[model samples]
Target: MNDVLHPSLLLFLGAAVVPLLRGRLQQAWMLLLPAAVIVAVFSLSQGTAGSMTLFGVDLLLMRIDALSLVFAYIFAIITMIGALFALQVKDSTQHVAALAYAGSALGVVFAGDLITLYVFWELMVFSSVWLIWCRRNPTSMAAGFRYLIVHALGGVVLLAGIILNVLDTGSVAFDKISPESAGFYLILIGFMVNAAVPPLHAWLTDAYPEATVTGAIFLSALTTKTAVYTLMRGFPGTELLVGFGVVMALYGVTYAVLANDMRRLLAYHIVSQVGYMVAGVGMGTIMALNGSAAHAFTHILYKALLFMGAGAVIHMTGRSKLTDLGGLYRYMPATLLLYLIGSLSISAFPLTSGFVSKTMVLEAAALDQRALVWLLLSLVSVGTFISTVLKIPWFAFFGRDSGLKPQEVPWNMLLAMGIAAFLCLYIGVAPGWLYSVMPEPVEYNAYTPGHVLWELQLLLFAGVAFFMLLKFVGGERKITLDTDWLYRWLLPRVVTVAHRVLQRLWGGLLSGLMARLRWLVETVNRHHGPQGILARTWPTGSMVLWVAVMLAASLLVYYF
Candidate 1:
């Protein structure tokens, strides 16, 4: 009944009960819990709660500021939506894992200190990987392990940074950090890994496609966005991030074009879309930071919706490869329609959620006079349209028929997608509703005549380009090598080679050792063998003569 309760606490407690209940009651409880959290989140006032000192340092379990509240709100909304999408799932473990993952993400958002943040930060990794592993397939399991290793390393890096920062500052306050401080870049890399920045981002595209149909919805929403929240909090205005952000945006677009798996392609777009957020954090202006937060919110919605549509296809057809998918629009017209809304939203088409949100970052860029940043981001938008809007839709749903004839997904899935789809359109049509939640005041206008005109032109051009390069853009039935190849292919090969070398070296040393031992045995045998002089029947005569000589010498010496 406490109004000051942490949303994460509620979710964690709810996750424990999911396995205990059954049937309709269990489903009802699952939906009710996140619904309640959403209400509670919106009801919260700006302040900290659950304050106490741990090991001589004060901690706030719930810090309800504008920024944290922004993330918390969207997180709660997506948890409910994800739960709804997963309502038909029979696996209680998956439900528990999904809820726990969402809770941990909320925990990260509201955490008022590095220690509290870390506790939830790690919990997010442990809880979310199950979504992948729960699929109970070899590919999913392998990808899950890789996901674990990458995040585990990232967590170690972040923890080291926290330890160094704490030692240097004698405090664990999670506030705006100075870049000159000791743990700055380490913490940034830690956050960057979560944000799915390039080189460190392959885990996303690698694992997300392998998750359960419903579980992919949550995966697409939480992990990387939470990293963006942290980056915005910890390292805003670190100009180095501008370059990193640009690379992430382009990197995602590039690989997404190569992706044959529909979900994997969308996963790459996650990295691309989050790039705007990372750049916004780097810009550090109020407008820019708000853009980052706004984009995270909108991204979670549209991205989750997109995943829902993709998952519905995968669930029904038992296939995910774009090369294998076609003429799906004829059978799954409704799903295609819903998915296009998401596709258009992601492309920042006019009057969509992406339009209202993504442009804020671009506006921030232009205002900052970062001409190259603006230009590159604009190009990423073009690529976004080409992939998600033009390429994916055409190839996956309308290209050459692969003889698929699946029906529409379940009512719950449709309802979930419907809700997200509606929201995407609604937010686009009414930008004020989303803008009002800005951590800072909203100043940039998304629907300006010039802005809308320019965006339309860019997308129009991208559409033209896609058709021109249609042959080149269709999904191929092949695996596109990524950074994951380092571990998946190269590392194992390297280990195998090293093992062989070590074995040969060990064999040579053992051979030399045996040879030396053999020679020593031969020398010892020669000294004591029956044919040797020392081994001959010596004797009594020699001994007697020697004894007589020794006695005579002793007698002479004594006389002298």
Candidate 2:
């Protein structure tokens, strides 16, 4: 390994040259960059690769540990897949933004200091927003702005926490810390915001569906997963995450059930799936932490696969709402088949990646004797099957035919989805391949007979319930509200009303002051007008006589 050359630097520098290339050359360049980074990642030894000191503060530019390596490997692989999916896009700007976003995520994964992490964190924020804006529509534009605002706020919170932590400890190292101080709590808030934990999560659902088709693939794979990586690294063992994670798990399912847009439905599932990882991090046991990391790895692949499948549908039909799509399977069987693979994986069916990864977290909770946590997670798994597996595929592919005949998406898109689908299956069948790369040793088996039977029963019952309530759970052409209402609607209205009241008060004060000044001017004019004593305009001679009289009086007084 070249000690001085960081893998992230390779992608970032490569992004700079992307706009300069054209056609086949650009496509080749994009593919080569991620492949080269994969090589760089494999060649490096497990330690800090690039280190430096600035102003007496130690900075680790590249930290190659088991955890970071796992994330870096998946991130590089997804970047390559996203590039492949986007090969048909003629816009260089989207390509550049996607590459830079990938690079920033890699930077965050490997950063060994608070400052370095923050720099990459902000870069991720800036670079990813462009992917949303690249759609060049009003909805995308507005969504991109909202995305930037939310992340910018998260960045501020993170910076404050970093500053306070550095001041308190006099060290800038990025390591695990207990949430015993104001700084760590603030830091957790920052991480949660990025993780899209419930109320702070609307930005994700708002922006991702609005992004360009190809851009949505990258958006789905990176941002929140990076935050998952950070939380697993920094705040593992905080009990608060357990509760929040459960709520997020259930909350996402509820919204996804109500989601009308296909992409939006998938967007909500990201929250649901990430909730498992967050809960595992909170559990803080070796198995749980390893579960979180492993879940992140599997989630990135499967979720991107899901997004790619959805993107292909939208690309072919120019419609993403479930109401507008139906009987697509007849036309795009390959896409439908590919999408079902993702759906099964996310639903944690037996012999899928989700089963392999998500069970670790649940088993940890069960071992810890958190009955409520275990129950809630179990229920959420059923909801996941209902919404993602049953609702999404049934409505989009097999529901009432909309009489729209659309061809399959381009080959590159199918190729990307194919690769992800294969991985999801491979990981499920050969869990050891994934478990071997985990941060800790793996002793748990996902394919135990008891576990498989229990999961099958849960999924089977959920499938039955979904069919029974299909009418009620059917997609409605209505928008459901979330915590985002506070900022998106309520807060803006409050600010506008406050502005009106303040404007009226200011106007009244100005009017009163003007009226008083007018009255004073009138009084002055009344006393000093042409008819008044001072304004009688005494001649120069009269003025001189008054001066002489005063002088004579002065002299008489002096004589006396």
Candidate 3:
């Protein structure tokens, strides 16, 4: 097992080669690397490899267990899918950024210690930002900057926690960190930020919508999902995460319902869906943890499918807003069909991947008597259906015709989405294959008659409500600001006001000081000028007489 080629290394190496080759060779390299990673991940066993001591501390590079294997497997799978989606993309930089982003995420998953994890954690931020910026526009550039800043801050907090925790415990093992630890909150906030928990989640919605289509595919799958993997690894069962998780679920749906941008709506849903996994980690039951792992795996599949579908629309129509799109089903029949499969799967419809995974968390909540948690989470499913299943299709493809005649997406895009759609269905039909790879043994059945009945009723009623309230829920043309308003809107105005106030005060102070300096200089010039009385020329004899008079006055004063 130690002799097995490292999957992360394969991707990083592949990324380097992406620029050197051209045309078909580069494309071949892209698919081949992830293919190799798939083989490497499946070949992994439960062991630590690449162990070493640095500065008198032991470090583990590779920690292969059930949990790590699960993430690594999906990451490898998505990388290949994303590469295929981008096969028609001519930008070599995107291919490199995506590969490196994937590599770093895999590194985080397989990391055996906090040090290794932190290193890869930062790499994920730096490498992935390029995907957003590669769109090479003002909006994307700004979004990329914000994305980089937020994730970097998260990484810093995480690093601070790691340093403090290591000093307190004298070890850097990346395991279940306790709440009582000095660095616990810092570490939790750091993870929550990346997990797209609210107040810290603006970056994802802001940048992801603006990312390049192909890059968004990788973006949707990797960053936050890796954060979820870390939470599953390091902070399982921490009570606060339950609160954060539930908030994320509600917050995402609220903003999503208000969204006009197709990708932005999907981004908010990322917050919501990841919320399920976060809550499961907080529950910390074997069933809950298994649910979280399974959900993370399926989420990558369906979420990527959704983003790819949305991306294909943007690619074909050169438009992404719901207000700008309509009646596209006929032109892009294959796109609409594939997109609906992902939509249905994400909504947790019976016989979908979400049906199997999302229920485990709710069932765990019920078992633990967290009725409020279960109820709120169940309600979130209604919103999921309204936003993803009902709202997106109603506005974008099946609603009134927007009069834009666009062609279908290219074959590569369809093939890539086709692969993801197939997996979403496959996992749904046979949940056991997914459950078997869970961090723990999963015993829950998602297809109980009562369970299936409940899901249908929830979705059916939600669909009905969406149509009933259709007048108000239609996409608005105005900008929808999230917590990002603090920076994008409020903070800049604050800076502007401060700058103006300082400028006025400095201007007045400088003007007054200059006037005083001019007065003082004029006084000196009046006395010192050649035309002045003191400046008049005096004879040498008069100066000598004054000196003698001064000497006599000194002698008289001394005698007195």
Please name the candidate that would achieve the greatest TM-score relative to the true structure: 2
User: Where is model 3 more than 4 Å wrong at Cα?
Assistant: 526-538, 546-560
Residue-level lDDT of model 3, residues 383-483, one tens digit each, is 88898888888899989899988999999999999999999999999988899989888889999998999999999988988899998998999878789
TM-score of each: 0.95, 0.97, 0.95
Model 2 lDDT tens row, 301-403: 8999999988998998899999888888899999999988998999888888999999999999988999999999999999989987888789889989988
Give candidates' CA RMSD values in order.
Answer: 2.1, 1.6, 2.3
Residue 144 Cα positional deviation in candidate 1, in Å, after optimal superposition: 1.0
Best-fitting candidate, measured by lDDT? 1
Model 3 Cα displacement at 417 (Å)? 1.3
Clashes of each: 0, 0, 0
- Clash pairs (backbone) in predicted model 1: none
Which run of 10 residues does model 3 get worst, by summed lDDT? 1-10
lDDT of each: 0.92, 0.90, 0.91
Predicted structure 1: clash tally: 0
**lDDT of candidate 1 at residue 420, scale 0 to 100:** 96
Pairs clashing in candidate 2?
none
- How big is the RMSD of model 1? 2.1
